[model samples]
Target: MKFLASFLILTMLTITNSITAQNQNTATKTITVTVVNATSDTGKIGFALYTKDNFMRKPIQGKEGKIKNGKSTVVFENVPSGEYAITCYHDKNNNDRMDFSKNRMPLEDYGASNNVMAFAPPTFENAKFLLKDKNLELDIKF
Candidate 1:
């Protein structure tokens, strides 16, 4: 009888732990992004996500956002808790690089989130989110 009881207890513990882990994986928040007028009718837009520490990496790969026509809406899933920002540019030539004029000024349109607040490149603090418990929504313009 004692052996049976021990087996049952062990089974229960294993089942409970499995369920807890599954719940933890499912406990993710959704991010609602609206990329408006991302490009002119003849242009395409490229976007990227970056963590707080590595700010200089060009065209941050992975984490693909959706684009249809001139606008896009994306939901980044399974994002672990951290600081992040989104930056984008209008690639008129689809050349995978932001074209520049002779003056080094962007010949193509470029933008970032929270662009309304400043004239400088936005800091992580300006765009960071806790994303610990619920969904988030942000609107970006170019």
Candidate 2:
């Protein structure tokens, strides 16, 4: 009967759509950023993910992680494959923000991708890393 055939087709389509959605979810990548030498484990670590176009201005994703054993790790899950940079700092004062001294020097410890910290502020080019289909682990030293 036409009714039976239509019902079967609809059920098959529903199953197919579900499988496609699950595949899409698994396709996105994950990045694990580990920050080392956090001054202390009292406050949390603030991290930011940046792209070339939005470097230092706006972070596409920002998060906070608890420090343990003098280190903190942040995981960015379900990320699309692209080039991105990372910046993180140990919020020693529990102020939920980075503190700067009168001379513009960082009051707390900070780290960037590739452990890059040169004369100038961290540039996107200096800290950029490739995120592919597979997972990534980056170790940064402050």
Top-TM-score candidate index: 2
**Mind giving the per-residue lDDT tens digits that candidate 2 earns over 3-84?**
9999999999999999998787568788899897877798999999988899898798898999999989999887887899
Worst 10 residues of 1 by lDDT: 58-67
Report how far off residue 16 is in candidate 1 (Å).
2.2
lDDT of all the models against the reference? Answer: 0.67, 0.88
What does candidate 1's lDDT look like per residue over 3-111, in tens digits? 9999999999999999998887668666666677765556566667677676547533433344577776676666654456777776777677778779676787766
Candidate 2 Cα errors over 4 Å, as ranges: 1-26
Candidate 2, residue 103: the lDDT equals: 90
- Residue 40 CA error for candidate 2 (Å)? 1.4
Q: Give per-model TM-scores.
A: 0.67, 0.79
